[model samples]
Target chain A: MKAIALKLCSVTGMKWGIPFVKLFSGEEVLEQLKEIWGTVGIPLIAIVTFLLIWHFGAKQIDTSLGQVPGPAMVWEQTKALWAEHVDERIKADEFYARQDARNAAKLAKNPNANIRVVDYTGKPTYIDQIFTSLKTVFMGFLIASLIALPIGIICGLSKKIMQALNPMIQVFKPVSPLAWLPIVTMIVSAVYVTNDGWLEKSFIISAITVSLCSLWATLINTALGVSSVNEDYINVAKVLQLSPTKKTFKIVLPATLPLIFTGLRISLGVGWMVLIAAEMLAQNPGLGKFVWDEFQNGSSQSLARIMVAVFTVGIIGFILDRIMVELQKLVSFDKKTIA
Target chain B: MALLELHNVSKGFGEGKYRTEVLKNINLSMEEGEFLAIVGFTGSGKTTLIKMISGLLSPDEGEILFRGNPVTGTSHERGVVFQNYSLLPWFTVYENVALAVNERYPDWTKETKDIHTRKYIEMVNLTPALNKRPAELSGGMRQRVSVARALAMNPEMLLMDEPLSALDALTRGTLQQEIINIWTKDKRTALLITNDVDEGILMADRIIPLTTGPNATLGPEFRIDIERPRDKTELNDNEEYKKTRNDIIEYLMDMGAEVKTKKTTNYRLPELKPIMPGKTFRKRKEEDKLKYF
Candidate 1:
């Protein structure tokens, strides 16, 4: 049972739980106590200290509108956001139910009656905006990965290809999402002419901007990873008389997966950050837009509400990074490769 | 026809001022079902020779013929066991072996491939480690998996490049005996590259020496002529084993000495005397006394 618990903790990247499990099992009590203090207790104490500092520091900092929101104020705003989301959900449900009932009645009264259900046009809540941001970032990250991986692999395999792409990659890599947004907006508007496409133009613009800003990380890391694969493994592939496709998928891919995952982790992070900035600039419907809207509102509670969005973005980014780490650990053969 | 032949084959690296002829005028041929071992010092182009034969590398000067046809790129017909175990780290022992089996016999059913993979893994005494990845296994165990993977391909010829060199003595002995047993069971054409004379003697029907490099070539061939099931302990006491061992060692030592002499550069040194620290301190003290006076 102790072993199982420890294994579960390790697998989930919750290594702090290991000492607790070991302590419970009555093995090396002193060492386990030290481990617990170092991993769990210290971090908890640090967080509490940070909160206390923030709580005090917030009272002194005054912006043009008001003072910065303390932790308590931010907490209150978080609850308020939840309450708003719940109320909006209930209203939406009621609207849909009423519309369905009226449509049914109309159909019953006249069998061939032409009745259309009106769509709910409610303002998106804080929670909805968060989901929207997540969706957009994922779309952007997916696009970036798709573009980066093949090119990266080819560049890794061939010296000539890598040489050709290196300069372009260097030039584009440092360009910010703010710079990309205008170009992407123009191109997306010009090329994507359909008004009733599956994706909105603003969403496409934000996603494309994110992809443009984020893809360089994945591309460079993947090429490095692919090129640095152990020569012995390549020789094994050769000795096996494997086809080029088989050699790549079977040998090269697996060998370079850890590095590829590192690249992906960076790409996803860049994509998320870029997506938010793009959304803010483009006034797209996401957390960035929500933040921008609250800033423009200039109400008493607006500062706290924006503070809520800040914490939400930070926590989500951390969670996304953790998710990538866990995914990398799952696929990587060596535990040491998890970084 | 010879099972495999290398005629006037030479390989070199770089060009112009930096050219290094790693292997030159390497000529060798192996008969069907014969086990040949090439014993060379480290950096003596042993690996280069084996790689050329396995078709992983091309010879610059001459052709390598397999069954009277010139060898081209790598083929499933020639399987190689590398010095460092090259089993994919992501794959378990079973998967590593299965990969070779699947590639070699693509027409075979999955069940047949699985059975074949398991059989070779069992041969290497790695059945218990079938689910273990290369990282989880010891050096010897990983090498065993590498051997299993190569054997599972069912190649007409096996090329092993110092496969047991990294292993501990006991593991090396065990693996050597296991390899000999497998070879005797179905005498496939096999080439073993090693720096160990005893290993070459124990495993091969004929042992050939590779000269020291910068332009290394094959030395004299020594037929083991020792009886099969050659016990390592008994070989120490055997007259023929001692004679053969002495001759090979002497030949290698002579070549080593010759290379050392040929490559040795004489440097002229300036004659100088060491200054005594105590004398220098006394001289400083005398000068201080004079200044005080």
Candidate 2:
């Protein structure tokens, strides 16, 4: 205030020496912070600085190669996605009826009084699409784990089994999910038949493909984890003459749980990522198809709309991982010894 | 027949490209209900000796007999307490002990198993922490829980590998007294692997010093003539205790220093100093002559 007073009131005449009060307080700023924060003052400062940097960082990002859109565009895209979803709700029943012969004609034609002007594009609601994708991922993830955990445990416990499986595991593990898609599609298409034959058996195909691709990482990592359990613990188990089933349930499983959980988390992450890509390529009704269609449209805000899906994916992946970590901590009561 | 016997025992590790001998010509016999302490320099095959006795590791050249029956792999008849606390951390103290009880006495009901587990838990003075996991327990407390776990199975021969080395001095002494009390109460056969001379004097009827590896063998056995329930604090007044402790210490110090000097010599070192192909040889005979002489 005094420096401003000297500059504006005294015509820059004591500007240097006029801020004695301000300087005295300024010198104590760090001291005050130290008193308030004790040890965390520096980290607090760093966090504030980082937030400032992030808020002004939009212009620096190059959006040419599918980088995340800025916050303003992302928010607008969310509204646009909502509008698209609303448009899709108007004609969904009619489109399914035209493709397959299973629709109630009156409901398809009327769709109640909820009918609106933009009703031709004909899509499922965004909520429905999200639910559909979530259902597939959960199903795939469950089956993958159900198969992988036992097989992985068997490989871990027996040297003979491990030796036989090692080559097959190595060969199949590196094979991409994209590569396996055709084979999986053919299998499900051949194996799973419907009562009405309405939607053409796409549901099971996508889920199975997702599972086959995602589960290898879990199985391999878990087997390795089980194999690495301390030899002394095995000795402990043997000396006690624990039955094989009891040994597996009690000693082996608990000892190898952290590793199994780690594999599960990784497999889950892969499943989520691959589902989006699989849905896009496989023409499955999911967030991927929605995002993929928007991208191909190339509207003025197409990129922005796709940005919303991208953000959702990232946030969903992060939340999924967090869920698994919390689950792991809950199940594994083993206090891991610090090596 | 002795309760446990090592007949001309010898052991080694690896084969072909990296073969190395660990134990050489170990012959010993233990009657039932005897407590023995084997004191040796670090890496003197004391752990290997214990492992061979427990059948965790097999001796390459001899038969380890439990009352004239050749030892195979691990069996509940001989229980081992490892150097580090290997209590399954997921289980509470009671659960950890109960694992062994459940395994050992599968025919018993859950109530009987609970009673069996709690009996040993109380024996180790860990009844209060029966529901506490290893992470929440202190080092000595964890060790006590391990002892409880081992004792719960009621193995005929108890094997301890420096079970108190990680504890503080006071805690070690406290547990030392507790272990002695347990041993005397049951009079089960026990073999303790320790480098502590005072511990050897306090706990064991006989102490054996092992020479340094890779040709390490049992050197000498000292019979502690001191009375039972030996007090670590007041052992200085006994003249025999003084002589035995000093003799073992002096013997172990020499063996320990020999290992330190001999470890750096790296008998496998090759090529760094321009060695010829012919010089790369297994000089076992020469090394043996140099070491044993």
Which candidate number maximizes TM-score?
A: 1
lDDT of residue B250 for candidate 2: 71
DockQ of 2: 0.49
Alpha carbon lDDT of residue B237, candidate 2? 88
lDDT of each residue in A4-94, candidate 2, tens digit only: 5544522322223334434455756655455446434566788778655654675476554444455676687788778877767656756
lDDT value for model 2: 0.79
- In model 2, the runs with Cα more than 4 Å from the true position are A1-71, A83-122, A197-200, A296-298, A333-339, B254-293
Clashes of each: 0, 0
For each candidate, the alpha-carbon lDDT, in order, equals: 0.90, 0.79
lDDT minimum window of 10 residues, candidate 2 chain A: A9-18
* Pairs in clash, predicted candidate 2: none
* True lDDT of residue B17, candidate 2: 77
lDDT by residue (A163-228, candidate 1, tens digit) is 998999999999999998898898888999998858988888898888888899899999998999
Model 1: interface root-mean-square deviation in Å: 0.8
Best by DockQ: 1
After superposition, the stretches of candidate 1 with alpha carbons farther than 4 Å from their true spots are A1-8, A24-26, A94-116, B109-115, B261-293
